[model samples]
Target: MDDQPSLARRGPRHSTNLVGRSSEWLESCAFNDAPAPLHIWGVQEMNQGLFGMLDQAADLAEAGEAFHAYMMAMFGIDDEQRDVPSAGRQRFRSSFLRLIQGWSFDSNGPAGAVLKGWVESRFGVCPSFHKEIIDAVPGPAWEVYTEEKMSSQFHNNAIWVQLDLLFEFCQWAIRRFAFPGQSHLTLYRGINDVERHLIVERTDRREAVIRLNNLVSFSSDREVADCFGDRILTARVPLCKILFFPGLLPSHLLRGEREYLAVGGEFRVSVDYV
Candidate 1:
C-alpha cells in the first residue's frame, strides 16, 4: 500500500452569501433533529459548488428562488405551484431515501453496494466495465473509482460518521485509562509519529488489522520478536486481526485487558505516553 492519507479533502469553498443562504434554508426547515431530504440535497449542492451560480443573482431572495427552480428541475417536478403528487416526485423522494438509508460509511459494509451502484449510475462510468482500459493503462480502474467515490458527498458523509464514532471511542478510552492530569494524547488522521506504537488500520467496516511496532513501549523487544517467530532483533510484530460489529464487540482477552484501554465497546488500544 502507498501509505498516504486516507480521508478526502474538504468540500469546495463558497462565497459568504451562498453559505448564509444555505444556513438560512436549514434554519427555516428546522432539520435539527434528524437528516431530511432538503438537508441532504442542500449539503450535496454546497459540496459540489452548485450553489456558486447563485452569486449571479441580484440578492439572497433571488438566489433562493433560483435555487428552488433548479431543484424542481433536477427532481423532475414540473409544476412550481401544484401540490399534487406525481410519478417523478415519488421517484425522487424514494431515491433520496435509499441514498440516505443505504449510506454505510465503511466500504466493506452492506451500504457499500448501494453507494457503488449510485456512483456508477450518477457518473455513468462503471469501474467494473472498464476492465480493458484498466488493463491497458498504468492505473487501476478500481483505484480510480475508489478515489472518485470517496470524494463524493455521500462518501464525505460516511467519513464524518466514522470520525464521530472515533471521537466517541477516544472519549471512552480517556475515561477508562485514568490517565494522569498532565498526560497528553493526540489523534493522527492516517499516520502516527511514535516509533514504538500500535497502528489500527481499518480494513473494512467491520475489520481492522492491528500492527504493533517491534519497539513499542508496552512490550519488550524480545517479546515482540517472539510474537513474530523471528530471531531478528528488529522484526516487526505480527499483525493481530480483529472483527467487530458497529455497536458491539467480543469480550476482551485476558491478556489484552492488562495492556490496553477498551473503547466504544469494540476497539482497544495501548498508547505510548509521550
Candidate 2:
C-alpha cells in the first residue's frame, strides 16, 4: 500500500456556502492542511457519464452530492456494495466529504493547478484560457452543451468525448463563480448545425462570446490573436469576443456564420472556423 496519508486522516472541512468564491479560493482552503499527491489516480478514472450528473443536479445539495460522487469515483471508491471494509469505507467517505466541501470557484491554487493540469493533459485546451473565455461573457446567460448531448452529425469523432469532458470541467470550475442575479447554465443537447451557428451569432450580437474548437492548442492570448491575420476588424458588439482554434485555414467557415468570428473592440477578431 502507498505510504501517503490514508483518506482516514482528518483535515479542515470545506464550507457549504460557496456562492461567491473562485476556484482558486476553494482549492487553497480545501487542501491547506493536506499533504502532497493531491493529484490522485482516481481523478482520471472519471468518465463523461459521471460528469453529466452536474447538469442534471437539481439544487446545490444535489450538486454537492453529485460532486462527491465524482470525487469518490476519482478516489477509486467502489459505489457498488462498498468493496473496502467498513472502516476503510468510512475513511474514504470522510475524505470525499472533505473534497466536495472544498469545491468552489477559482482555479489558480495548488488544487486548481492540479485540476488544470489534468484538464490540459486530458482535453488539450488550457484551463486558464477556458476560464478567461467564460469570464469574458456578459451577463451569464451562457449555456454549456456536451458532445454526448449534441447531434451525432455535429460531433467531431476525433475529439468529441474530450470536448464533452472539457466542458464538464469548465462547468465544474464555474459553478459558483457566476455573478449574483446571473442565470443558471442551460444544458443543451441535440443542437443542430443551424442552431449552433445561431447560438454563436446570438451570443456575439448580445454580449461577449468565446467559442473554443479542438483544432487549436491555446496557451496564451497572444497565440489566440496570432491565429487571425491582418484582417482583424473592429467589433460592433462592445464586449463580444470569439476565439477560433488554430490550424483552420482562413477559407474554412461554418455555414451561416460570418467571415469574422472574434467580437471585441479592444482585441483583434479572428474569422476562421467555429
Candidate 3:
C-alpha cells in the first residue's frame, strides 16, 4: 500500500457533464449484494431454453460449436452471404467476437471504447481508464472515451445489442454448466506494477479495493497469468461478472492465455508482489 498512489492524488474531479452513470448501481450488482445475474433480460428468456441445446453436447468443444451456430442464427449472420445485401444483414455481420478481438489488440482503440460503453450502459459502472484516466468528473478523458465509442459504433453497424445478448448467454452458460454450484471463482490478473493500478480503497496492508476498467481481462490459470507480468492480482470474481472465457467459445476464438473477460467495478483484491 505504501508504494501505491494515494487516493488524494487520484480522487474524483467532480464533473457535471453527465457522461457516466452512478456507481451506486454498480455496488448493488456485486455478488455480495444478492445480485440477480440475469436481471437484464430476466429468467423467462433463459426458460425458453435457447441454450438448452447445450445439454445434448458431450463436451466443451462440442458445446462451443453449437453455441456459435446458435449465435450466428440468432443474428441472421448467415443471411449476409445470401442474395440481397440489406443494411440489417451487413450490420448483423459485426459480432461480439469481432468486438472482443478488436479490444484484445488495443484496449484504447475504438472497439475497446464500444465494449466499455456497453458495460457502462448495462452495469452502470463507469470506466476508470481509457487511453488515459477517465476521472470521475466530466472532462477531456470522458470526451476521448465517448468519442471513440461513438465513432466505433457509428462505423461498425452498432452491435451493442448483440453484445448484450452475448453477455446474457455467457452468464447463463456459466451458471448452468461452467461452475454450476459456485458463486465465485478465484481469478488472477498479471500486472507490470502495483502503482499502475487504481487502488481506490485500502482495507489493510494485505488487501485493497481497486477500481477496474469497465471491461478487463483475467485468467483462471495462475501460471498463464504470471507469464504476462511481475505481479499478480488475485480476486474472488463473481460468476455474473464474467462476460466470456476461453472454453466458452471455440478454441479458435478468444485465443491467448486462457483469458476470462470480466465486467469491471470496485473489487477487493490481494496483490502478490512477486
Candidate 4:
C-alpha cells in the first residue's frame, strides 16, 4: 500500500466554534504540518454511502453525474418531482450548482459567505477574509461575517450536506489525477492588493505564511490568473485542500479562469507585484 501520510487516519467532527477565526486556524487544525504527506483532509469517517459511488465510476463525466444525482436527492429533487418544503423555503435556489455559480458571480455575497462558513465548519479552518477582513477576535467585521453566513444558510436548509458530498467528490478526483506520486498543484491567484490579505509570517522578501479565506478562487494557468489583477500570489496547494476545480463539473457551471476553490488554512506562498 502507498505510504503517504494520510491525513484521514482519524475523523474529526466539524468544529462549530472554530468557524471564521483566522487567528486560531493554524493552532486548531492539523494542516499546519508539511503539506505533501496529507492525502485526505481529516475526513476518513465520512459515511461510506455519501461518496462511494465515485469510486466505482468509469470516468470523470460519470462521477460528475453521480454527484449531481446525489445533490438532487439531498434537495428531495428527482426527474419527476420535488417536495416544496424539502426544496428549501427561500428566494434563492438551494441547489449546489447555484451556490457555486453565485460564488463565481460575487465572492463577497451571501453564497460566498455560506461556502466559507461550510469550510470553516468542516475543516476547522477560518475565513481570513470575507466582504471585509476577519480575525479571531470578534468585532464589527465578525458580526457582518456571521450575519451573512446565517442569512444565506437559513434559506438553504440542510444545504451543508450537499457541500459535504461535493468535497468528497473533489477528493476522489484529486486521487484519480494525482498520478506518478505528485501530491500538490501549483496554483496562482491575481489580486488588486496584497495588503488586504492576512500575512501570518514573512519567511523572505517574496515568501510568507498566508492565511487565505476559508474558500478562495485560484487558477491553474498563470495567464488566466494575471487577467484578474496587477498582483499575483502563487502557492503549492495540497490536493486535500481543493474543494472544486475546472472540469470537475460541467463547463457551463464553472466558467472563467479555469478556477479552483481551495479550502483555507495557513500556507506558505510567494507574492509578486507586477
lDDT of 3 at 248: 82
By lDDT rank, best first, the candidates go 3, 4, 1, 2
Candidate 3 residue-wise lDDT, 95-147, digit = tens: 67766766666767887888877777766666777787765466898899888
Q: What lDDT does each candidate get? A: 0.28, 0.27, 0.65, 0.63
User: Model 1, which residues run further than 4 Å from truth?
Assistant: 1-163, 182-226, 229-250, 253-274
Please report the candidate that would top lDDT against the real structure. 3
Q: What is the lDDT of residue 264 in candidate 1?
A: 9
Writing each residue's lDDT as its tens digit, candidate 2 over 1-274 gives: 0001101111122232112222232223122222112221233355657656666866544654565465445555445312222354343322311211111222222222333333333323322122222222222311221211232322223222333333344334334322223322111111112222112223353232222221111112332333333212122221101122111211122211222221111111223331
Give per-residue CA lDDT, model 1, range 1-274, as digits (tens): 0011111211111132212233222221122212122112234433344345544655434543554455445544344222222345442222222332233123332334334434233212222211112221235644554554454444433433222222232232233322323222221112232222222345443233333210121222333323322121221211111011122111121122122211100122322221
lDDT of 4 by residue, 1-274 (tens): 0001112112122444322333344332335444433233434356566467767887887777776676676576443222122235435446566677777778877878788777766656556566665543377766787788777444555767667767767877777743325567788888776665556678899888766665678888888788887877788777767778877864455546678887765567888976
Quote the lDDT for 222 in model 4.
Answer: 84
Compared to the true structure, candidate 2 yields what TM-score?
A: 0.22
Candidate 2's error at 81, in angstroms?
18
The CA lDDT at 154 in model 1 is 42
- Which 10-residue window in model 2 sums to the lowest lDDT? 1-10
Error of 1 at 261 (Å): 11
Off by over 4 Å in 2: 1-100, 129-205, 211-274
> Looking at model 4, how many pairs of residues clash?
0
Residue 44 accuracy (lDDT) in model 2: 30
Q: Is candidate 3 or candidate 4 better by lDDT?
A: 3
Candidate 4: stretches off by over 4 Å: 1-33, 36-52, 77-93, 152-154, 177-180
The alpha-carbon deviation from the true structure for residue 179 of candidate 4, after best TM-score superposition, in angstroms, is 5.6
